[model samples]
Every structure is written in structure tokens, then in C-alpha cells.
Target: MSAPPDQGHVLVWQEPVQEAWIDYNGHLSEPYYVLVFGHATDNVMDAVGIGPDYREANDASLYTVEAHVRYLDEVSAGADLEVRSTVVGATGKLLWIWHEMWVDGRLRATEEILGVHVVGGGSAPFPDDIAARARELLVDPPEEASGRIRPLRRA
Candidate 1:
């Protein structure tokens, strides 16, 4: 199948680094990287009708199965950063998403996340309605929006 549209529409979430999130090196800690990305994922899910309410109604939830993040720069304590995410790919119950951390329009990091649909506790196939909603939001980065990084690849 052909790739989805590279619309490059960035969903911006703003937050400042708290004292607890700082590391010995005087920057946001490594674990918080996933935390910020997780927040971004939740935003994207809400946009696509897969938020907590949807899960509660459908008896399904999306869980991250794998996440790969590359830290290109350091974010200092008290610094405000924005986390942006886009849907890269989706099929069956799996979704491949890409996220970036930005400070003042400069990219600080990039993350590739793989999420799976789950029911109760185990892996479960995506229902038709949810799949359709996700497909509607599946997006590709436009050439101008891609910047220096390549498009997200499937796992």
C-alpha cells in the first residue's frame, strides 16, 4: 500500500521541566523522555477517538509495546518544551507513531513508538470501528515537515 499523507500537522503540548524531572547532569532525566512522549501519545489518541473514554466504552486500550528514542540534545531544568506526535502507520491492532521533542522550534529528540490494542490484559485485534478511526488519522510527514529525519519505518 502507498504511504499515508505527510501532512506534518504538529500537535503541540507545552510543559516545563519540574525539579523532580531534573537529572544530575542538570537536564531533564532520561526516563522522563518516555513520560513526555507518553503524554503526546495520549493527545494523539484523543484526537483519533481512542482516548480513555473510548477504551472504557469499547473494552479496549492501546498499550505501548516498544519505544525507541534518540536524544539529540539536552533539555535543562525549568525549560519549557513541546512534544509533537503524528500517526505513521496502523494495521490490524498495531500502530506505529513518531514523536519529537522541541524547544524553541529546534528538535531535541525523536521517538518511534509501537502500540498494540489490548483487551483485559492480553493482545487483541483492533475492532473495525477503532481501526477505521485510526486510519482516518494516519498521516505522513510532508517533505517540508520531515526536516532532516527520515519517515518512520514499520517495526
Candidate 2:
């Protein structure tokens, strides 16, 4: 899965919405969204050669420094979900990724993530090969995360 076959293409990862992930209201739970996005994240990581092999060989790993998610719609159990990720930005030590969650051809959610490469305990630059491969997949860096201010809605 190193860097995927097509770096410029969307990395689509698909999975079913699990029944155990449903909440009392019968929709996907808050935490499960994070977990599914994480599955996509792991796919991206493996693609960029930062997986278990890298961890074992280089003694380096990634840590989620920050993340932002917007829940736009509900996802029910038994629905098939697709999470597509595009690398939006990256540096020697940091990777910025944006993900869209699709259900039935409709966009259901979005997640933006920032991960830092860690060697030992502190952040360190990514390996040259990894960095170069990721650069090929880069997109326009997103705007800085702004604190959201929710407006009143119809009740």
C-alpha cells in the first residue's frame, strides 16, 4: 500500500456501518465516526510507508496532534460507508489530510486531520522517501481552523 498506485487520486476506503456502532437513536455514534475515519487514516499511513514496519525499523510513529470533524448527516446501521482521503498538505514532520464520508452517494461528514511524526517522544522530520511520496499527493493547504460559532436554528 506504499503511497498507493495513484498518488493523485482519492484513496477510497469502504466499510459497513456496524450495528454495534449505532446509538440509542439508531444512527452511527459520535465516537464511531472517529474510529471509521481512523480506519481511513491507517490506510493513508500505510500508503505512505509509516505503518508497523516503519515503526519497527525506524522507531518512528505518528500521533494525532489535532483533528476537526463535521457531522453533516445521519448514518444508520447496515449502510455501506465510504471514506475518501486526500492529502492536503505535508511537511517533513506534519501531514494534513481531509476526508469525506459518503453514504449512498451522498456526503455525510468531513474530517480534517493533522498528524505529527514522532521519533522516540518528540516530533521529528519524516524520512526523505516518505516525504517525497507524500508531496506528490499534496493538495492546497486548508484555511486555518477557526473556532465555530453556531447560529440559532429553527426548533
Candidate 3:
């Protein structure tokens, strides 16, 4: 139920695919994956002690400034999905988060985000403890972390 004491939390968000999330084409819609991955990012922020209390107390919160989502496969309504998040790294005010959405035992989508810490309406450094821990867990960003989504062109 929890990661070993030596390691930080293994961030995960699991939920059932909602019918309302399906689009007219009858598959999970592009925006819905963003919604689900957003939830996962919330969980990650909370686990790192940047949750509601932190915001209310410090007036600091993480804002996603950039995001890249890859729709790798299709998911249907009622399918079970899980999102796993990794802390890629952190600069003074920015934290990079990576998420993988899985369904039916396969990777369905991925989202990589640039998260900035804001305090009193301006970008600020992440707390020392959070930065240290996140840096420790940081690995090289995933291979897919590069590139933008674009229409496939003829090779």
C-alpha cells in the first residue's frame, strides 16, 4: 500500500473510465486524458507536500505552464485506467512531471508537464525539502519526453 521508507511515495492515480468522457466517436476523448492526467498531477503535488494546506499557508502552488500529451492507444468507456507519475527534475521554480496512463495492460497515453511554483502570484522557488527529495528521485526524463504532437506527415 506504500513505498518503502527509503523511497519517496510512488505516485499513482486510478479511476474507472467515465461514460461522459467518451466523445461522439465512442472512444475516450483527447480532453478526457488531460483531465485524468490532471488528477494524477494533483496527487503528485499533494504527495510532495504542495497540497491545499501548503497553498493556503504559503500562498504557493504549482502551475502547469507546458504540457505534452501523447494519445498512444484507444480506451473505451468503463475501462479501468491508472496513471503513474514520476518527478523528472526541478529547477528553482519549476518541476517536471511525467505521467503514463495504462488500460487493458497497455500504455494508453502519456503526459509530460512543466510545473512552476508560484507564490503570491509570482514564480518562486520550491521548498528546500521538496526540491531535495524530488531531485533525488529524478531520473533522466523519459525518452518520449521530447517532441510535440503533430499531424503525421508522409515520410
Candidate 2 local distance difference test against the native? 0.79
lDDT of each: 0.73, 0.79, 0.78
The residue pairs in collision within model 1 are 5-140, 6-140, 6-141, 6-142
Q: Is candidate 1 or candidate 2 better by TM-score?
A: 2
Residue-level lDDT of model 2, residues 12-91, one tens digit each, is 78888878999999899999999989988988887778988888988888898888999999999899888888787776
Off by over 4 Å in 2: 1-7, 141-155
Q: Estimate each model's TM-score.
A: 0.80, 0.86, 0.86
Ten contiguous residues with the weakest lDDT in model 1: 1-10
Q: 13-32, model 1: which lDDT tens digit per residue?
A: 66677789999899989999
Q: Would you list the clashing residue pairs of candidate 2? A: 3-47
- Order of the predicted models by TM-score, top scorer first: 3, 2, 1
Evaluate model 3: give its TM-score: 0.86
